[model samples]
Target: MANTSFLQLSPRAQRLLKTTQDFVEQECIPAEAIYFAQMAPIGSTDRWLVVPPIIEQLKAKAKELGLWNLFLPKIYPEGPGLTNLEYALLCEVLGRSFIAPEATNTAAPDTGNMEVLAKYGNQKQKDKWLKPLMEGKIRSAFCMTEPAVASSDATNIRTAISREGDSYVITGRKWWISGAGDPRCKIYLVMGKHHGSKEEPHRQQSVVLVPADTPGITVVRPLPVFGYDDAPHGHCEILFENVRVPAENMILGEGRGFEIIQGRLGPGRIHHCMRAIGMASRALDYHLNRATDPARKTFGKLLHQHGSAAHELALSRIELEQARLMVLKAADTIDLHGPKKAMVEIAMAKVVVPTMALKVMDRAIQAHGAAGVSNDIPLAYMYASMRTLRIADGPDEVHIRQIAQTELKRAAQVKDQLKHKEERERSLRSRL
Candidate 1:
């Protein structure tokens, strides 16, 4: 339930939510094993080249069911006109299964890239890339994280977008670029230093829309999380050596990359949290199912009958509900106020939800004993992804620092107010 009983969802969003729930549970979850089974073997050249057949089948079904691209919030005319709050509900359902996100064309890197194009790209850029992306005919990657510097502080990025006459020559190294390994990935929304910019340090960077097929682009290797390769769609290390595009490809003019990312990441952080809650919910279901399995009794009683396991289940349930409420609140704030206003809430959710998911899933794995760590169940893989969430988008430490800075914004006023209150209390005591 995610404790979201009070959301006043629009009729269309409500309908989509139900449909998404059914699709993820009945189709995506069940088809997961078949989807994996159909993949090219790990060491094969086709491993990254061939997507499993089951995924396309699911996509076809999802499109028929009117469940595609639900992540785009209603503000963008390019989107399906659902609010951020509405999509949060549907996104949780998608989180229950690994294949559900892409099946519905609501996966990350793409969703975020779509938003970037819709928000910042020109008409030419939109027609060539956004149209194909929104239609799911092509995929894209966001190249921002670099290996040489601390990328968390985005100003430290050294990738160069050098202008040569009427074209921009881009040269850089980026790693952990999601979706870069996909055959359908045809564009890259790259962020790099706008060469020779005299603006402030924060404004020295810019984003550009580079066609993926352009010369001098090389995918060096795929990066794995824990042990999972996530092939077909991978996180990759790529080199851009003098990749050239028309200067018009620069997004929203130079010196605006920081502003663009802030706009992109706010909603994205919430989406990640929503999906994590869904994963935690599925893990809790595993906990309950395994805890009550009659054939798997422990010490002559069902596992849940044991005091320790019972407590763990209760704790997980509480944490799940709390995590859900926090995420939904952040979503509603974004819908009501906009992403900039919801920064504090988004930061809190980003910091909390992924960690909460790991805790809940870890407990579920423990309940399953040896089967949890093995390939017999999905918990281990799910945990690996959930663990990575803590560092993705923006890591917990980054968000935690943000939360603290935001909280302290009112510290001076609060200190004065508390001092006044103390003085009044003393005055009242003296009069008595």
Candidate 2:
């Protein structure tokens, strides 16, 4: 049985969380302007995929302070070995800033990829790609989502990976593959169908590690989210036209892609939910700051004094607190039990957090009126990113379906157990 009690962080986790909070507030948040300045000319040749100098400086500082690689639980010797719950708290703090995750080497795609490599990659694969990824020397992308199918259903993916003599030839077109547009992104964990119609649908897919520089691989374009390209870490459309990698590069061999995805996405979903909470909290902060401004008045009173505005703030607080608890509970479930056992909790959080975050950001944007949507504040971008979460990883409908089915099955089991208990009681009473 899962432990469904209050979770207490270890002394080490508490210290690390405190340290991370301090680092984000003091250093990461302050560096946003410089980061934006570097990313201002999104179409420029040099700036498009360039990591800002301030970010590197902040990364060096984060490394010096031992705040790097706090995401991986037990994979790397250099990692701090924090559990999912512990890392969720720190991830919330990092979510306040767009660049904070990469600064501390705890970013997504990389985090998921690192975990996959640590758990499944052979030593040679680890030495070639995972080592640099863990060290933050290079970035990586997960090529799973495709443009030709409804990717929410993994079985619908059409990318094909066929075995050749001493190598595997991968042929497909994938889009929304985050991090593929970056110059530093040197590797890709590509997911494709490995078996033909004869095989089981789930088992037919496989994941292979394709070097970004492999022949016939093309980065078609960087897809933008609500006009924001998220430069240096873009979601790209890529074409793998007969791209070939050594047969040894297949992760965990063929027919294990779905298994790897199950392991990878459980944590990834929780991490996204944790960060969404942080983003919503930051949006609330922005909203409160704007509303409480003494000079800003609406209907002959300060915005905060207005009844509707006040209610919005109150509602935001309540919703954010509830969403945070759900994320924490999901993280705890993943920590205590395996992902499979915690699937229901993860699905619940995955569905709730993003929706809640979008609501909070919408209110924040409304509160600020013009400045909210403008680049003057981060709310617009935050909203766009949060909006994407509703569809990314798995869509809301998919998670909702999963959670509902689990609940229905649980209800049926409860009914059966109650009936059995009643039967036993009746038999005992009759004997008495």
Candidate 3:
């Protein structure tokens, strides 16, 4: 049972939590090996086509059980009609099993991409793209990062979308375009500069919808993480050579890409942190069980009783729970005050959660002895993964800068208030 000493879910969320937890324990857990095994054939390729039949069966089962589209709000037609907080409980359960997310149509890149389209897309854009995405009939990729620039500084993005009569010519080389290699990935939402803008640095960029089959589009290769191909799904490097699309394909008008990213990323960022909390929790449990078990130890004493080992495990547990609370508090803030008011909390959680996950994973790995480095457990993968997250959605340095700036601003305000109070007190004394 979870330590409910800190926070409690509403009745609806409680029900959602139970349903998803049961689904993971029953369906997803049993099918993990099958899903991974199916991935073996496509190990060399990056297309996510191998599991459609299996996923269709799983999706059918999930939808029939009223478990479909648990990732979205009520505004989306297919969702279970839950708030971010409610959906977050379901997400945590799904996070426990990797297959559970896709099984319920809540997988990443797609989920984040769908969210952007849902908010900023015009009717034609929505009808053609958003509808298929929501239905899970097709997948999408978000093309923002590039190999040629410091992508962390989004304003440095050099991808060019130039106007040419009634069409736009897009030319750029993009890397880390996740889900681009999927056979079913029929669309890309590309972020690039709209060449006519002499606008604000943040406002010169625009998001355009590009069909996968568009002319002059080329997929160079897929990138691997820790030598794992991540096949059936991949992060691809692609070249857009004067790729032409109708000007109407632009989303939310020109210069609004940053705005869309701001809105889209708040939920996406928090969700990633939440899922990471689950991953760390799972790794800690696996490590603790392995180290403490009689068969895994020498000299007849449980490893949990070992001096430094026990302390590290205790620390990992505390860190994991602390990070989880931060994530939940961020979620609650977003739910209650909206993303605008919750920006500080969101940024802070992003910075804290992944770093905490990395620390917990490192301790878990050390406790595993040599087997930690091997694939025997998910610890090694989790560690590598958590480390990557420190850079994935903007590196830790950038986030720290934001956090510091926020703290300094608050401190300055406090200083000003104190000075004003002293002036008021002195004036009152003189009058008396």
Candidate with best TM-score: 1
Cα lDDT tens digits for candidate 2, 1-432: 112135587888777777788888889888898888877486775655567789889889989988898888743564678887888888998888788899998888899999889888899999998889988899999999999999999998889999999999999999999998788999999999975647788889999999999999989988999888888788999999999899999999898989999989988888889888888988999999999999888779999888899999999999988988888888878778867898889999999999999999999999999899998889999999999999999999999999888778789789999999999999999999
Candidate 1 off by > 4 Å: 1-3
**What lDDT does candidate 2 reach at residue 374?**
94
Off by over 4 Å in 3: 4-8, 41-43, 46-49, 74-78, 417-432
Higher-TM-score candidate of 1 and 3: 1
Error of 1 at 41 (Å): 0.3
Supply the global lDDT for candidate 3: 0.81
**Against the hidden true structure, what lDDT does model 1 obtain?**
0.90
233-263: candidate 3 lDDT, tens digit per residue: 6889999999999999998988998998888
Q: Tens digits of per-residue lDDT for model 1 on 1-432?
A: 454458777777778887888899999999999989998988677988998889889999999999988898888888889888888899998999998999999888888888988888889888988899888889999899999989888999999998889999999999999999888899898999976788999999999988889999999999988878988889999999999999989999988999999988887788889889998999999999999998987679999999998999999999998988999899989989989999999999999899999999999999999999988899999999999898889888999999999889899999999999999999999999
* Candidates' RMSD to native: 1.2, 3.4, 2.6
Ordered by lDDT, highest first, the candidates read: 1, 2, 3
Superposed model 2: Cα runs more than 4 Å off: 1-7, 75-78, 195-197, 417-432
Ranking by TM-score: 1, 2, 3
lDDT of 2: 0.88
